[model samples]
Target chain A: MYIILFVKISDVGENTLIEIIQDLISSSESRPDFRRKENLILGIGDDAAVWKTESGLEISTTDTMVQGVHFSFAYSSWYDIGWRAMASNLSDIAAMGGAPLYALINIGLPIDTDVDNVKDLYKGILAVGDKYSVRIVGGDLVKSHIIFITIVIIGASSQNLMLRSEMKSGDVIAVTGSLGSSAAGLRVLSGALTNNSEMHKSIIDTHLRPTPRIIEGQILAENGIRAAMDISDGLVIDLNRLCNSSGVGAIIHTDKIPTDRRLKSDFSGEEILGWALSGGEDYELLFSGPESIVLSVIPMMPAGATIIGEVSGFNVGRVSVLDPENKPIKLNDKGWDHFKL
Target chain B: MYIILFVKISDVGENTLIEIIQDLISSSESRPDFRRKENLILGIGDDAAVWKTESGLEISTTDTMVQGVHFSFAYSSWYDIGWRAMASNLSDIAAMGGAPLYALINIGLPIDTDVDNVKDLYKGILAVGDKYSVRIVGGDLVKSHIIFITIVIIGASSQNLMLRSEMKSGDVIAVTGSLGSSAAGLRVLSGALTNNSEMHKSIIDTHLRPTPRIIEGQILAENGIRAAMDISDGLVIDLNRLCNSSGVGAIIHTDKIPTDRRLKSDFSGEEILGWALSGGEDYELLFSGPESIVLSVIPMMPAGATIIGEVSGFNVGRVSVLDPENKPIKLNDKGWDHFKL
Candidate 1:
């Protein structure tokens, strides 16, 4: 494939852009493992996409990423923007322990935006979506002052689906993988962290392309684990939501909270801890179940799954962090809120 | 519910605003006709909304409405905005001869936006959604420079579905309801139509709250009317698309074309004709099948159904309009193109 530099979207009208998208998607569907192609009764060039579904429960989630608000072209490419947007929605399906099946993408672009950029953006979205065998079935495109991508995914889950409100008082709270890498990666990309170490590059990659913990979520469901959620708006806030929904409280051990080793080495302890506690967009699985069951499940989970805390009856609906010396650490603020930010 | 007129979204924060939305939706769900409530395995507060589906084909479509570009709040109410957005997507499902089952709305709003306005917007959505027993199941919210609503709908169709590519030569082209009413309504709202009569009020209502031809489409599909499309763009352009997709052409008769009677009486013939031919957002179904079959099925359709033209083998992939004298009318352009517009 060759790049045609400087072809503005206005050069090709909406019809032509749609034709281009149709062409790209159709070609992609020609790949060997394109799963939904056979089940699709109607794909592109329809009023809507039609696909066959089995008798079961379906899970759905929609997410939107707006330019200047959720992302900026300055630090991220259109490819990154598309991939990250798809990943975020895929993570929601993961949080539900569902298998991603189909996606509908709505893209709003400025008239003068590059046509090549839009192609790359779809390629980026497809890159991540194809990894999970999620098919892009349908979408809409419109003109806007700001660019944004809204992805709606349809997934399927077993009747025994995981939910946030299923945690018990004696449940163990475990998180998959380390945290704060995305936050540190953001700092590196913004040049806030100027250190050009190899660790910084990995951290930057984490921010740019965080993997959705889909497999881990499905495994947890298969193992009879009930309560699960993806840590999106930072650990403290998301965990608070989990506890609140379950009518329970949490007691977290700071030492057991998985902090990125690279982040620990580069920043102060408080700074690293703050990033782990409050930095958003981590896309890691956080689940709670019985202590013995979770401990046994940990070894079977993806590497780096750590038991960080426990659901406690001491307080009905509050979360507290304990230092190594068993003193409760006070958190002035919970986590990042889009409006607060 | 009492109005809290001056409360801005920023005053409550995102979580609180979410709580308010959850409460609003839950209350709406409490109504007797809330058909999806019982079947919904999980709703709103979970990672994603879960629902039961049978073994069958599902239809899905996504549409986005951007502020200023799609509508002006100066003329359209928040309710109109929400209703129109959902109508646009519902029309897609209608085109596919599918029944609307669920809707997910992703809204991007400015922080300074009024809280009551957002509530009213959702109320508008639920108003329309409940009309067809479509439930508000899931969604995402984010901040944006200009507000936009992206609605994704999941619908279901029987094994036998209507499609644009199913048209054949010698088929009769028919449309549900009269055209140009929506364009006329827009003109009235924009002050382009100054004479405020009952006709104008009806036309304005048509524009603000166009209904999806769901029942009409189902009847067409049940009658084995193979080729179908919804007239979202003007008659000529959307018909051309149908013809192009089916590898056929059409000759629509000007005299037979169903222009809104009110529009025809109030405006110049040319202006009303232009709206019928090139103005958009009609939300009516245009379908084609064998002439005998279509004629037999006409009696079963809605009252306004009209036989406007016939699909032809000549010209294979173009659409033309014929005056009463059988002279071909020249089209400057087919219809609205979002980018070109």
Candidate 2:
């Protein structure tokens, strides 16, 4: 008899798992099917998969949200859950500067789940779909012990594609809308803070129902902005990913980070700053371009765009945050990792 | 204080749930985005969602499989689970006479799952992907209490499309390959039946790794056969669905059902017939067309197609199975339903 050993996902972490997957895919490159197709513009390592279509390019993306891990029903209604789920996928397409065309939803729920709740979930999904002209084509519903929703969105775009690997040294980095409110909203929902003000209610709504920046992303793409990504995993972490992909570094000023003024009225500066830095789920668009082009397109943005930093060549893949005094600030948390120990 | 009551999914049943969904989608028809899209050929109620492309048609479908609900690790390896999940989506595309092009795999696993197991799962997915020249484009990995996999597949087909609503009276119903082995193999794995013969191993393999009838579906489509669907639910139940879609009915002879010779040697006639009628997960293509066209295409099928029944005008949306002596046999069980009380 022989003994067997096992290695858990937490032991190697999410990054290593991704690396292993890449390696497996690369190793199969010799196979005819795995060979790179001419029409496939991008695959595996991007916000959305891209391929050439008749007139332009087709974009596809998928996102999965698990109950308890992603959201809690104690604070989020079924409609909110559905809206958030569809929003996440729509945001991915927005990050790529693509307009969503169709979506297929896959839901797994317990048999005893309320029928009205499930219908409300679809209502929320349709609400977002209608806003962006995305059609709900088909889906699969299965029985499960825990609840989960997975949405697959297909979209279209012109030749102008926003990509993370296109960031260049000396390009200015900017973000649309505000951040930290969604994370702060979670703090309120978790009962870490107590507030019943109208401002607090708005913050909670921001967390529950996010609007993907479709028009803003299109404006940037149409105006020649090439390097961009959505701020899903916080500014510092996602900026680091963009830098790593582009083989560069960045220096963002904390004072220049755009955040909700209403959040400042309720939370401490330190608490708000921390949330803004590493608080995930803020579906704002973070993009980089030349200073002249970036400044030219700012006025066209609906939610307003702010220049937060500039890309650099030194300390590749690292993001340095500076205070108003221009001194580097150290961060305690790295962003969200599904398999982090 | 205010009180609210909830109606559980089991309260209305799966059919009612689907009808409710249809009502919701139809009610939103006034919205500009919800209006009929010119390029969309088929929308909600089918094996796959279809839309027109420049040269042909594009097909998409999604399926979700939850651990314990769909499969258990006690008998199945992670590799088998991945293969089955991908196979389900592939079979959906095949049912439409489409050739799969790309796939996005979304996996939700417990944090403590073994890393090697996940790799084996990908290996299994890639094995099937490589067989059909399907490229694995992108996916999302999330944390969950229960392991689940959702795969979204995109495929393409020529103008000739096989649809469920195209069945006509006097059409001969035929199916590719044998059935009942998969359900029988599940019993062997569940320990309800004990067997150690070589044929038992083959039966177990059949249950573990099912091959979708892609070539057979395409041949039927190219040869002018129009109505078809995969035998995922039982033959009787799936046939009923075909009839419902076409506004017709069917009568299938139980004696004509093709079964594995090895399954017949080990299991009773009643047990084998029950599995064939409603065991589901067979992944065989059940199709109907003119008798001459169906017989003409039989020579092209790799697995040898068998004529099992014929479509009729009576008993719309109903399926009747007749015995060898011409007596009607009553079925105690319908096909698989996620929410059946």
Candidate 3:
């Protein structure tokens, strides 16, 4: 039998790896539609990337994803990994009511990884970046036994910022678009359920390429919505966090929680509600504001918003969910915690 | 036999981990001398941190260090690891002639790691930040099989920026402070050398806690020096990078290279020279400029400057070293490449 050998990163060395990455980035940056921002003084291949700043508030956030913990290649492609990573950071900026400007990506890969896989990852990152006009300014690459990606994104806000601590007890709690679908989609990927239907494909797409509500977040912030956060670690935990920060509590009407029609048809009522309430990674923006203001901004949200909860003054940090019959619903799980035993 | 139980990160969970980290940061931030910048609109405990910006150029860079690859706890304390990581990014900002303003630290720890070790790491990070007036604005903590730290620093610079591509022929190449001490120190820590004297302690400190030449870099840029980069991957390789970026060559006088006096007292002449030329992690600034401008800035550098080479027009991207007799010296190795086999 003929032997086959695959080139590893160790064979080409770090400098060559950097050159390869630069080449990949150059190709993406050279696209006809890829416009370079005038504020950027220098791009990659320097001691540090440089950019000019306008007089405004800047938002910065960082997120890290590890292999077998945050993601796995068994179902998720490298492209999906990159897209998801960028989307998470983009969602953070959106949650802060900011427009993403630049990003710095740091990746740690096993030396045995194929260089082509890295190119595919960069392509995925560029795809989402192009969608939002976010520029890839600089990044770091190193060798590790296990793969990981840490991304830091810098964005600009128009003075007004939506903060979690701004939530008032009288405010209405609402979320943009549907939830539970991404969690359900992840379940499908993890082999909990299998079907070749179009709905299944849609759910998988939701899990793999969730959209960041940037414009909707900005609209809410501009329309006088003072408090907002992305539902990444499920509504229960994140809402509790917002409540804790604001020294308030919340009450949710379970029946009013938004979920995809397909999700309701495919899963049991309890399962769908559980995923919607506690299964995280939806990337939908949850916000609180006065009833009138919240209603006024509903028309401006592209994904639409559904009011499901109300902030309360009693029992700070407590989130009580009510069923259709108005009885308190008991949930077994709170949300996703990376280090929770 | 006695059995003992230690606290693992999994026992405390991600949320508690965050609270612990916040407490640690709060303690450091509350120091009497720690003055918060007015531009920082919001610090931690938000979806994303917010900071107002002055109208100027911003420099951003990221660096990642793996556990076994970059450092070993046997020789490097958790505090040193944190300080060194920050210093690396600070050096990058310095190389761009920028003043560090904020840092975002991302760390990945094994599930079994002790919580106290992480506190030590943060303490180390805070110490460095305090020294340079760089604020820890935001960060992410994640669980991984292997430990790692990725730091992204954002700095503000005047209109002028020192770039690697700005070097030209006939420029005098100078470096800040002495080199080789860090490498020599590494050897001592690795057990290749044995020493317990005060000189050895100084060398070890040089290897562990390197001083980034931030002020020196700004002085050079203000004095009209254009091309500069930090010697991270050794003088030979870094010089070649500068040469290649500028499409020029360089010639170095080996005897002119600087080394710590204690290093020479402890190591052989050849060993000192070898480490000075090819040993990485010096964190010293290597710059090229007109002879007059270089000389004029030398007095302003806190660590002093030594002219060791000159940019040349011949043999583009090649770096040649000459001995006392002016004969060419051949190096067995170039420099450190993370993925080099």
lDDT per residue as tens, model 1, A1-341: 99855443334332343454344334444544433324443233211122445765567787899999889988999989988999998888888778887677788877555555666687678768767766555666687889999998887776657787788998899999898889888987987767699998888888988898888888888888889888888898888878877899999989988978767678888887887888878999889999888887888877458999999986977889899988999885635545432
Tens-digit lDDT string for candidate 1 (B148-172): 9999888777655777777898888
Model 2, B75-128: lDDT tens digits are 999999988888888999888888888899999988999999999999888787
What pairs collide in candidate 2?
A: none
Q: What docking tier does model 3 reach?
A: incorrect
lDDT (10s digit) by residue, model 3, range A90-173:
998888788887678888877656655666676677667666766555677787899899988887776677887888998999
Candidate 1 clash pair list: none
Candidate 3, B73-142: lDDT as tens digits: 9899998998899888889888878888767888887655655566568767766766666655567778
Sort order, lDDT high to low = 2, 3, 1
The C-alpha TM-scores of every prediction are: 0.84, 0.97, 0.85
Model 3 chain B is weakest, by summed lDDT over 10 consecutive residues, at B41-50
User: Which one is best on lDDT?
Assistant: 2
Runs with alpha carbons beyond 4 Å of true place in candidate 2 = A1-5, A32-36, B1-5, B32-36
Candidate 3 residue-wise lDDT at B97: 83
Give DockQ for candidates 1 onward, in order: 0.16, 0.70, 0.16
iRMSD, model 3, in Å? 19.6
The candidate that wins on TM-score is 2
**Model 2 C-alpha lDDT per residue in residues A188-299, reported as the tens digit of each score:** 8888768589988888888999888888989999999999999998989999999999999999999999999878787899999998899979899999999999999999
How far out, in Å, is residue A283 in model 1?
Answer: 0.3
* Candidate 1, residue B9: how far the Cα is off, in Å: 35
